[model samples]
Target: MNVLRFAMMAAICIGGFFPSASSDALVGDKLYRNAHIWTGDKKAPRAEAIVVKGARIIALGSSEAMQAHVGKNTQIINLAGAFVVPGFVDNHVHFLVAGSDLTSVNLQSATTPEGFKNQVAEHVREMSANQWILGGNWDHELWGGSLPDKTWIDDVTPDNPVAVRRLDGHMVLANSYALSLANITRDTVAPEGGVIVKDDRGEPTGILKDNAIELLMKVMPVPSAEEMDKALAAASRAALSNGITQVHDMGYDEVGGLTWNNLEAYRRARRNNALKLRVYSFMPLTEWPRVATYIEDNGRGDDWLRWGGLKGYIDGSLGSGTAWFHQPYKNAPDNSGFAVIGSTKLSNMIEGADAAGLHVAIHAIGDRANDNLLDIFESVSKKNGVKDRRFRIEHAQHLSSSAITRFAVLGVIPSMQPYHAIDDGRWAENSIGADRIKRTYPFRSLLDAGASLTFGSDWFVAPLSPLEGIYAAVTRRTIDNKNPDGWVPEQRITVEEALRAYTSANAYAGFMEKGTGTLEIGKLADFTVLSENILTIEPVNIPNVKVLRTVVGGLDQYIADEGPVDLGTVE
Candidate 1:
C-alpha cells in the first residue's frame, strides 16, 4: 500500500458509472452508491449506498433511498459494483516500531546466506559509515536451520554497527562492531531468560536471544523526536492507504528508544491533527507505579489516541524456541521453553494495573503461558469482582481444549494474529509435535466456545495487511503452500467471521464499538472499497483483492484507480 494523499476536488470516471451532472453541486459531503457494501452491522448486513455528512455516516440504504441526502455540494462516488467494508481496526501492533521498519533494511525475504548479506550490503552502501544498521527482520528459518553470525556482515559493514532482529523480534544478530559498542565479549554472562550464542571455542557468536539483546539495546542510539515524527507520519499514511482506521499499539521495548518515543510521537501527532488512525496504546506492565501515575494523570484519551492498558510478555516467541510450552519443542526435546518473567511479578503487575482501572494485554504463545495467564485473570476477577475488564491475552497461539472455553467463561479477549498461524504453520510441526500443533491457533474452537476473538497483524513481525490476515483466518493455509487443504483445517473460519474480527470485534475489544466499528447511521465514515466482492469471491482469491479506495471521516484518503468519480475532500 502507498502512503495516502488527500484531495479536495477532482473528477474520475468509472465505466460511466456516475452521471456527469450540472456543473457545481451536491449538498452532502460525499455520496457513495452502487456498492456491495458489507456494513458490518448485524441488523442490516448490506447496503447499496451511503451518505456522509462531515465525519459521520448520516444515512445508508438503497441508492434511491439515499438520494434525498444528496444536493449541490455532494462529492458523489459510484462504486461500479465494488465491495465496501468498514475500515479495519487492528487490535494489536507495535506501531512505532512498525514505522521505523518501513524505513529500515528489507530482510524479511532474505532466504539464503548470500541473499541476507547482499540486502544488508545494499542498505549499508546508502548510509553514512557511522550510522547504525537496524530493523532487519531476518528469518533464518526460511533458509536452512542454521543461524547467522556477525562474520556474515563484518566485511560488508565494517564501519557500521549493525543489529538486525529475527522475524519474531525475540532475537538479534549483531555485527562485530555492534558487539564492541555493547562491550559483549566471550566472558559476558547471559541473563536468566536470555542466551548469547557461542562458537566452539566459547567466543561470542554475536547472536543474542530474548532478553540478552538488552546488551545491544543499552548502546543503541535513541531516535530524535524529529525522526520519530517522520516515522509516525510514514506509518500513518501507509496504514490509511491499507484501509486501517485505527490500531492498538502494543508497547515497544526501550523507553527513550522506540517505546517511550512512540508515546511522545503519538501525543505530538494527535496535537498536530496528523494522527490518521485512532490509537490505543499500552505501557510496560512492569512499570506499575509509572503506568498508574500516567493513567491517573491522562486517563483514557479521546476517540483518537488512548492509553488504558499495559503490555507484557509471559514467554518468548515460538520462532526463537522459547515459548514456555508445557511440553518440550519437538526439535529441541530436552528444553521446555522458559518464561520471560517470573509468574509472581507478572501477577503483581496485572493486579496493580487492574486496581488502577486499566486493562492488561500480555503476550502468551505457549500452552503453559496461556494456562498461567488464565490463572492470573481468574485470580484478578475473583479479587476485583466481575466487571467489563476486557483483559486480553496477546498471541494466545497454543491452547489446551479446556482452555479454549475458559476464554469465553472468563470473558478474556484472545487478541491474536492469524498471520502468525499461517506463517508459523509452515515449520511449526518441527517446533512442536503434530499432536500439540493440532491445537495451535485454535480459531474454530475458540469461536465455538463463544470467545470473541480479535485479530491483528504483529506488523513488524508480519505483513500488516488485514486482507492477508483475514485470508489466513478463513483458509488456515500455511504460506509454504504445502497445506492446500489448510493447516489444521478445522480451525478455519468463515469470511464474515474473519471480517468481523478485523473490524467490529477489534472495536468492541478496544471499547469503541458504538462509535467506529460498523457502517451504521451514526458511525464514523471510515470504510474501504475493494476491487472484488470479498464476501462472494472464491475464498482463495480474496488475498488477490485490491483496495480500490479508502475513506476516513468522509474524506478521500486513497484511490487505486481514479477513473470517473468526482474525488473531493469534504469541508
Candidate 2:
C-alpha cells in the first residue's frame, strides 16, 4: 500500500471518497496546464499539472496542485512548456504492413538502376490491368550492388504483376508477370530457410529468398475485408499520428489465409469504431495451431485486441543476407545464413510454447541467430520450470558477449530495434566483420547485462518513429553522417536510456506493465506531447523531435495543429 499511498488511495477512490458510491467520478475532462510530465513512473513525481479524466489520469501535481481538479467544465490545456511522455509502446509493428506501406511504391528510396525502374514506372502508371503492384521495401544495399532482376522490372511492369519486398522480409523482386504467376522457374528449388537470387542464364532471375517469398506471395491479390478495413484504418491513423498508443502486432493471422484475416482485421476494427491503436497480436509461428485454438477460445482480449505471442523464425534479416550467421558472410564467403527453426524443431517449439502458457516471439537476427536463440531459451528454461514466461529474443540483433549473458540469465526479452542501430550502422560492418561490428545493436551491452530492453520499430523494416527510436538510441550516430564517433561507440544508449526502452521497457515487453507503461495516478491517459526537450535534447536533436500532441485513453488522440482548436462541436 505505498505507491505514494497507492497514488493517494487511487486519488481518493477516484475522487468520490471511497465507498464506491456507484463508482462514477472520472469525468474531469481535461487540464494539462504548464506541462512537463515525463511520468514514465519511476515512482511517479515529475508533473506540473495533469488532471485528464474520462480515460484516467485524474489529478497529477503542481500548477497549484492541478488547480483542485480543475472543473468549470475543465478543458484547459495551456502547455506553454511542452515535454510530456509515455504513449509510445510500439514494441514492434507491422500494423497491416505499416498501413499497406502507406499506399505502396516506396522501394525504400530506390538508389539506382534508373531509380528502380523509375519506381516501377510510377507504379505501373497507377496500376490497374489486373492490379497487383504491391509494396517494395527493396534494398540492394541501396543499389550499386544491382541485384533486382526480371530485367530490372520487366519494362516497367509490362501490365502489372510486380512483388518487390526486400528490405529484409528476406528477399523477393519478381516481374515477368510475377514469374508466371508464381511458377518461379529455373527449376525453382530453394526452400528450407531460402534463397533464389540466381542469374547467369539459368533463367528465373527475379530473386525470391526465404521460403521463396512464399512462392510469389501466393499469386498476389488478396486485400478485401474492405481492403483490410482500409489498411486497418490507415494503420490506425499512422499509429495515432506517431505517438503510437500501443502496438506489438507482427504477422497476425487467424488461419485459412491468403493473409488478410489479421485477426479478422482486428475484429473488424473493434466493431467499426475503427480501432485507434491498442493491438498486441503476434501469432504467425506459422499460426501455432490456430494460435493455440485462438488462445483457447478468446481469452487474451482486453486491451483492444490481444492474441498473446508466438511469432517464430530464428534467423533472416540484417537487411536480407538472411541473418543466421556464426561466420561465413564477411561479404558472403560461401554464405552462412540458414536456420529458420530446427534445433530439434526449436527445442520442440520452446517446449510446447512453454507448456502452453505461450509467449514466444523469437526472430533472432545473427550471431548464429543469437546463438540459436540462447540455445533454445536455455533448453526451454531447463525443460519447463522457470515460471514467469516472458521469453522473447526478436532481433536480439547480433549479440554474443556470450549472447549478452544469455539475455540476463535467460529471462530473455531483448525485443530491440533502436532504428536497427541507425539503420544497420550503414552496411553492418560490411556484413559482420569489424570484429562482429562490436556486438552490433548491443544497446549499452544489453542494458549493462541486466537485460530486459524492449523498444521497437521493425515497421515495414524500420521507421515507426519512436522519435526515430529515440534518435537511434541516443545517437549511436549514422544516418549517413558516417558514424561520427559512434556506430559501435560502446553501444550508445541514454536519452533517459532511450526513454526507458521506449516507455518502461516497452511496458515490460507487452504484458503491459500493469495498465500501460507509466504516468501514475490511475495510469491509462497515454501520453506524448514533445515539441522539444526529449529530456533537453541535442543527442543529434533526437531526430529533430516534434510530435506536438498525441494523447490516447484520455482522448485528444493527436493534436499538432499549433494554433486554432475551437472545433466546438463539429464546426
Candidate 3:
C-alpha cells in the first residue's frame, strides 16, 4: 500500500475509529500543539501539531485536526509559538572520548602560556600523583601559533604525568614525567607515519604527532567500566541539550587499541534503558573481519544502538600541519604533509570491508587525501559488483575543484563538519594560500553539483551544538569576527540547506532515513523545539537561538525549563 494510505489507516486505528467493541481505541500518549513545525518532509513540509503514541508519530496535522487523537490519558503540551523541527543528527563524533573531554581540563580557549600552565596546574591539584592528565584539546594558535612544549607544564605538573593533545587530535604534548614513564627520549625513533620534535640541543621536546602519539598510549590508564559509563551518560546529556537526538559515533581506534570498551558501554546503557539518544557506531576499518563476523552472528542492532560500519583514516588534520596535500603548505614551504596510512593498505582495507558487506567511511581532510580516497572508492565499487554501498568520506574538508563533482558522480557522501569551516577560516588562508583556500569547504558548490552533503560537530574538536553549526554554514562567519562578511561568502548555503544537512541528510547518511529524520505518521517521534524560528530569523542570529526541548522516540528527553503542566487532554 502507499505511504499516504498506510498513514491514514494508522491514524484511524490510533484513535479516530473503534472497530471492536471489546478493545478500546488507541490514544496518543502526548500531544504537542500550537507551534511552527518544519517536518523536513518535502511532501508535507509544515505542521502545527503532532500526536505521539508509544515510540512513533501517530498523527500530525493542523492543531484543530489533531484534537481527534486526544484521550483522557493524553498529556497536552502547548509550545506557545516555538519552532519545532526534526531532531538534529550529528553525522560524526567521538562519543566516548567527547564524554571524557567534558569533565577533563578546559584548555581549548587557553590563550596564554601562563593560563595554559595554570589550568593544568589547577587540574593536577584535584587528582593523585600517579594518575595521567589527559584531554586538553589545547589550541596553540590562540597564543600566536607556537607549539606547546613539555617545559610549559612540566614544572606545574611535576608529580602528575601529563599528556594533553592539540585540539586537532593529531598532535600530543607530553610532560617530562609522561615522557619518562613512556621511556621516550631524543634517541627514540619516530615511526614512518609519525613525528617527534626536538630542540637545537637534540633533546626531546615532548611533542608527538600522528602515529608517534601511540608511544605514550602504552603507559596511559585504560578507563574502567564505571568511568566509561559515566562518560557515556555525560555525552548523552550534552547531545540532548544541543538538540541532537542521534549521533553517528565515529568509534575511536589507534595503533595500539580499539573501542570495544566504548562499544560495551553503549550496550550497557541500552540494557539498562539509560540510553537517552540514538547511536550508530563504527569500528576501525582494520578490524573489518571482526565486524563481519559479529554482524553475521548478531546482525546490526536496533535503532537505539547499531554497528557494522568501519572508520579509517587517510591522513591527519589541517591544524596539525599533517593533513596530506598535493601542494606544500604556503607557510611551511617544503611541507606538503604525509599520509597516516599508505594508499595500498588503505585501498586494501576499504575493499575488504566493502566486500564483507560492512559500511565504510574513511577520514580525508586535505585535497590530495580526498581525491585519492575518491579514486579508491571508485575502483572498489567496480571491483565488487553493484550493491547498496553508501561509501562515505568523513571530513572531506579540503577538496580540489575537480573532486567536488566526483562526489555526485560516484554517489559518495561527503560527511563534513561545518563548524570547522569557520574555525579554520581564521588561519586557513595562511596555510594553503589564497588561491587554494577559495574552494575550501565548498558546501554550496557540492550541493549545486547534486552531492548528498551531511553535517556534524566532530565533538571534542568542535562544539556539539548544531545551532552554532547552522550559523557557521549560513553566515560563513569566523569565530574571531575577522570575517564579518564571511570568510568564504560564496561558499555559504541557506539556513534551510544547513538544517537539512543536520536533519534528514544526516539520517540518510546513517541509513536511518525511513525510521527517523522527518515528522510523519508511523515515523519515530524525534525532534527538537527551539525558542525562536531559526528559519525566519537572521542568519547571524542563528547561534543565539536556544533549544527549548528535545524529544526522542516520543519521549521528552530534555526540557530547557521546568516544563509546563500537562493540560490532561485536548478537548
TM-score of model number 2: 0.36
Candidate 2 C-alpha lDDT tens digits along 1-571: 3553455545532422222213235335777868777786665547776766777776676665555555457677777788888888888777787677788888888888788888879877877786877677777877656677778778777788877677666777778887888787888787777777777778878877776677766666667788777877888777777788888877722111243277778877787766776888777665566677777887888766787687877777766777878788888898878886578877787678778887888777888878877887788788888688888888777877788877887788888888878777888887778998888888888888888888878787788878888888877787888887778887887788888888878888878787777887677888888877777767787777778778878887678777224323110
The lDDT of model 3 is 0.88
Best by lDDT: 3
My TM-score estimates for the predictions, one after another, are 0.93, 0.36, 0.96
Ranking by TM-score: 3, 1, 2
Regions more than 4 Å wrong, model 1: 1-27, 254-257, 562-564, 567-571
Rank the candidate models, highest lDDT first.
3, 1, 2
Candidate 1 residue-wise lDDT at 410:
95
Model 1 vs. true fold: TM: 0.93
In model 2, what lDDT does residue 514 have? 78
RMSD of each: 6.1, 20.9, 2.6
For model 2, which pairs clash? Answer: none
Worst 10 residues of 3 by lDDT: 15-24
Question: In terms of TM-score, which candidate is stronger, 1 or 3?
Answer: 3
Model 1, total clashes? 15
In Å, residue 379's CA in model 2 sits off its true spot by 26
Q: Which stretches of candidate 3 lie over 4 Å from their true place?
A: 1-26, 254-258, 562-565, 569-571
lDDT of 3 at 513: 93
